[model samples]
Target: MLLPRCHRIKQPASRSLFQSRPAGRLFIFMKRIGLTGGIGCGKSTLVDYLIGQGMCVVDTDQLAREALSPGQPAYDTVMESLKGACRLEDGTLDRSALGHLVFNDDKKRRWLEGLLHPVIRQAWESRLHTWDREGCPMAVVVIPLLFETQAQDLFDHVICMACSEKEQLHRLLQRGWSQEHIQQRLKAQWSLKEKMDASDGVIWAEGPLSSTFQQWDQIYHRIVSP
Candidate 1:
């Protein structure tokens, strides 16, 4: 149910709630849509489909990885705060080791979030500004922690991609993750129920890919049409 892109271009929607900079003429034509989901809910796959549809898509997970890579400011701060124990032999942050450390310990988890969230948010905003000027069809940001970080207000619309817990566990198993790893990651965020309650829309990923795309198509039309 997508309105033609030209219709969106001719009659833009109101400015996005997540937009920080001025909604220049270009951005006036673009809408910012956020897609969030838990560890095994298939958000990445949906984002890829959106990108294929000619939308600008940014994966905050990828940005977080970049922000924490060796020599990045975030990398430096994390290593300094934890006193070098979070590093691997190659001097890069041992993400798996760090994950184990924080996932089980509330105190360490808070400290890690305190250090990383601000940096990642800033990076995300920068990318958002850059893309807004490019006059893309629309923009999609994949933020796994959208609700956990209280960033739901940062987008024009927030979509939660969800699945049954049984399906979630099954998906995680397919990824070769241990049951303990799955539960540990899931425990770190707001539960699926909470995420849906907070989002403007919900795309249940338990069905076929075509069904998921159909939901996405409807979302794009709702947001982008003048």
Candidate 2:
């Protein structure tokens, strides 16, 4: 089902993601794809696979992490906003502590998003522009909250990685997350069903690793070959 469910590259990426950039920059439009899903849904694995296939991938989570690292502009802003609530002894952000802070308090989470989302989006958009100018054929941006953040415009096609909630919880637990921690994080994002319904294609991430990846490989070939 996953292999047969490939969605082709759609035309006219949402302009909202790059309205600020100059127009008519690229002779050939770079095929931009958005990869999104719930937390612990094997997005990293898919990203690696895509990267091995020579795709330029922009992982927004990694962007966010780098943005909030010590000495970064957003790092200063977060520390100032949180009054140094979860900083480490080395003056870097204590992400685990910060996660606990934001996950438990909706207000703080929203505030953090307000501060982080624009910066991350701008960073990736700039990269997309770069790739297009460089004549890159295709690129993927991994944004877990693509639909929730209204960032679908950032890509020509959107793909969702989905597995059962039980499988999701199991994956998180393997990562040393407590049941409560898993629940708290999952509650913040749209459910797998909702994401899959909204995406142009869905990668049902169940069963063996090879099986999951075979699904993604088919979708990739369809997008790039079509």
Candidate 3:
């Protein structure tokens, strides 16, 4: 059975950019929800469901990819930072090479984050402002490192998706990730337990598609309704 609506939940304290004033009083406001989870935890699947339900979803990963593309703001800096190690002959980024480099080295990973994070933040904020101006009722921003980047403050509520660690590893392996790469990526983020404890809601993504969708439907109604 689905969980009941959480009527006792408190309103967010900080005002978001989407809040609107009407007749001298605040009225409608867009609820900015952050959906996050570790890599290979099926966040994209949940995001698709939300998009299908008519919620505006701003995927940070998409923004990052754009930012890293040639002629984008982060592209030159990233290539320079990597010292051409991950630059392809066609003047594009070699993602696999870059991934292998940074995931294994703490300093390089931090350096890369430093370069890309500001650009990603700017893009995210810009999109939110656009959606707010368009009067979107709610938006879900997918930030894979929401907690890691200390960006939880940007959302009205957070939903963390989780699965068993064994399942997590298995899923990544199915994606052709090496065991070492999987471990490195996992170690880079906050544990699932930590994310779950900090979030307003949790979605266990260990079961069948129908079950996951059911949970998502319940959570979606709760968030989109009063």
Candidate 4:
């Protein structure tokens, strides 16, 4: 976690017009990095490390949860659209029930995505732009479905977490998901290799998290270096 000082904060050659001056600080390019991977692939660990290093992050999962809370636009929309099918006895939306409904049917999955993705995307992108305007040097957006959602254009760089299938299943099992459930989730998204191939950077996560951090540190310097 010992990242060197990004004193110079150089921009990559391909990026354009991100450099902005802020009083006495070094000119920093507004960086919006997308962090993504399969479920339980340690994106949270990386996000914690980024926060520790003073980077702002928008967690789309958190935003999606907020959207489902009562009085939110998405909550009202779902009730009107789905006719309370996802509702619980106490009147709260049954998240587990909704999840089960979606995971089994491609139509349901697309319907849920259609309901929530736009709101979540706008929320995070607006936050990132606001931070950039306020002189934040860099920010991260943790989107587990970044590729699936076709949101790669929203970032200056996308860093994907890659690991063996065995490791991915092991981590999910630790979270109490069954193998059948894991398979369902996996089938819905691009494989780890495909994500890595499409990403600007990949953090190989077959080993310890410190190793993952080490890779990020290297990518950090590479992306921000002269």
Candidate 5:
């Protein structure tokens, strides 16, 4: 991808007195961009391209995994809520087992979300603030449930990656996922049409990778420009 250099970065805006405090305490304003897409829409690939274009990117999926690691607060809360229903003999939580418990059942899914979302939100906010303090020009947040979670308001702009249902299914199958698993994961997310309607911009990912990279380049230019 060949992205235009950021005009904003070349011309730093003047800061208010509040932003011109002591070096260690000074604050910097950075754009918060939300990147979302449906399952199998190649969102990770898009984020990678954006990162290559010099945008600081945060992976919510990776953070979610971190939030549930053995010693994490949310992990302890989840274990207490599940009460050994999702635990292994070795005392660690069985994530695959827990996934089966919630993915197929809406009530259980909501219950788990209730337990985890708050912690995830807290962590996300802290990271955002830290990045802002460090003077990052802008950042991209890779959120898979941006629409479903009603988190669009959290970002200055939202980008949705999209593909045809057939293409999505084919991509999932290529990853060796079963048909049932694909359907279940799809059921867990809003449809592509819904996400596109709610997004500030859309990147179509059904074509070749080269074409997708070209779209990414265009988006990078738009994002970094005023």
Candidate 6:
């Protein structure tokens, strides 16, 4: 399947302080594992399971949020580009508002990604470097757009979490997402089939939580012992 041209690396913006670096060359000592899946696909559940087992988890979603906070790296640029359409009266970013605009428009979505991905990658690389220096064995990075951003090369291993389409839609509905909104978000990502095909491992997130836990346990042991 042909991915959108946005999935490929583009020329760097000259004024941006953050730049993408090759993860493989930057952190050779630590085992870096990338976790990704479609929206509502239970990637977070797997991330939490890994965290409970004492792995350091770097969440790109969280980092992106931080990057957009008032004084952070991406804040000023976002405000300037979005022209206050996604900002609150009190000067905070209205995430839901921004999400609505971007999800419905491919150009806007790619623009936002172009603004944020470099900053996010820089932050993730910094954390990985710190972990390596501190003698950490492995770190799990939760990036929802790992494959879309062509970030699979950044990790020693990559895991794609997935479930049936029915289950995915149901889960998103439970979280108060409208069916249309969910579909739009899903459309922005690589299909689960493609992600699973490209990944080093796959975790089916269909069944009960205990079943998911058991699958995670097996993967954990394999990563640690193999």
Q: For this target, which candidate reaches the highest TM-score against the unseen true structure? A: 3
lDDT of 2 by residue, 1-226 (tens): 2132444445445453232226544354578889998888889998988888788998999999999998899899989988998888899899999998899998989999998999999999999888977778788999999998998865688989887777778889998988888788888988787788788888877789898789888887887665
Provide the overall lDDT of each model, using Cα atoms, as 2-decimal numbers. Answer: 0.77, 0.83, 0.80, 0.79, 0.76, 0.79
Highest lDDT among the candidates is held by which one? 2
Which regions of candidate 1 fall more than 4 Å away from where they truly are? 1-29
* TM per prediction: 0.83, 0.88, 0.89, 0.85, 0.82, 0.84
Q: Rank the candidates by lDDT, best first.
A: 2, 3, 4, 6, 1, 5
lDDT per residue as tens, model 3, 1-226? 2222232223565655444454455546878888887787789998888788887888999888888899876888887766878888999888888888999999989998998888898888888888876778778889989999999988888887788888888899998999999889889989887877778777778789777778777776777664
Tens digit of per-residue lDDT, candidate 1, span 72-146 = 988988898889987888888888888888887889898878888898889878888787666555678899999
Instruction: List model 4 lDDT by residue over 82-171, tens digit each.
Output: 799898877778887777778988887888899899999989988987897787777889999999899987777888876777777889
For TM-score, candidate 1 versus 6, the one ahead is 6
Task: Report the candidate with higher lDDT, 2 versus 6.
Answer: 2
Pull out the clashing pairs in model 5.
none
**What TM-score does model 3 achieve against the real structure?**
0.89
Clashing pairs in 3: none
Q: Mind giving the per-residue lDDT tens digits that candidate 5 earns over 148-192?
A: 788877777787888877888888899777898778877887878
Who is ahead in lDDT, 2 or 3?
2
